[model samples]
Target: MTSTVGVSGAGTQDYDVIVVGARCAGAPAALLLARLGHRVLLVDRATFPSDTISTHLIHPPGLAALERWGLLDRVVGTGCPAIDIYAFDLGPFVLAGSPAGEGFDVSYAPRRTVLDKILVDAAAESGAEVREGFTVEEILVDGGTVTGIRGHDKDGGTTIDRARIVVGADGLHSTVAKATAATSYAEKPKINAYYYTYWAGLPMYGQFEAFDRED
Candidate 1:
């Protein structure tokens, strides 16, 4: 059943689900839940078309998921090149092959600015109430159960929204996870650093390459 908003003593709004973070993970979840006829509220601290550090590689399986969601074509329409070949450089020898599975033969590496906006838009289109630049400050708990969120918008207007379920898709060090004292098992510390840059005239010829160095 669809959620209904009811006024409470705290002036709180209501929804079936409240999704914190509206990027890759949360947006899709919000869209799917809204599509299933549930009232969904998707909130993000940043605005759309924002960039973030990410691998940016969408493999065949990921592409298949987007295909099932009918978003593959939208991503393809962004003019991002398709990657059909994979090459690994081990300094001594190289191994090269194509990634194949689930009837998908190609992958993509779209910029997060573009890809994330598309996802957020999809969630909004699917009837999710999207709140960009909304920072979730607190997760409400009643009887040891997560009930909602207290946050604000860019203008610093505080708002409290209640939900049947609260989702923490805010990535590492999520506020919801911390509020609930969620434990992480088998977690490893950072072993390496990553740096990324864009090139204008370089060509890959549909190849995705990874290099290993001893430095």
Candidate 2:
């Protein structure tokens, strides 16, 4: 039987949307949702301004999205240099050009530590609850549909964050994805690998370079 809902369970409905992984993708989504007046909960296993292994460059399209979300200035303000040129070194040939057209005349390669915090801060400014260093332990499911998440905090305290919808913005090895039994169709094996490290006082600050080598 369908019963009338009341505010008594409002406390249990912790949020309208609970977003896991407060990085680039998840943070922006939470920010937009919060700006639309929805109660959003953004959680991440790591703290903000933390470094993660990934490409730092945000292309023109991504830059446009940040601009639309009113965060471009904040990201650029972090002292990340603007990239207006691209160079590709193919084994036998080299290709280069300014791909950013009109609205997007440049790109930014801010460190994840800088970029993520800007997004998380924006999400908080938009009214989304932000929590860091919280690890999701389980995805709560009711009968079949996902309802919330069970996570543990830094102090080993467990908490259940219930929401009307749950989003997994976690990276490739997302725990939420595993809990939800999501399918994967990786058609090709990883053909290459790259590593990143800190560098200082070198040239080429505002340019994109892609070098292709035959191994």
Judged by lDDT, which candidate is best? 1
Model 2: per-residue Cα lDDT over 1-215, one tens digit each: 01111111233577888888888888888899999999999999899779989768888888888889988888888877889889899979989887575489788898888988898999999999999999999888776667788999898999998888788888877776777677666457888989788788888656788998886
**Ten-residue segment with the worst summed lDDT in candidate 1?**
1-10
Instruction: Estimate the TM-score of every prediction.
Output: 0.92, 0.90
Off by over 4 Å in 2: 1-12, 185-188
Model 1 root-mean-square deviation: 4.6
The number of clashing residue pairs in each candidate reads 0, 0
Q: Global lDDT for candidate 1? A: 0.86
Tell me, by TM-score, which candidate is best.
Answer: 1
Please state the error at residue 188 of candidate 2 in Å: 4.3
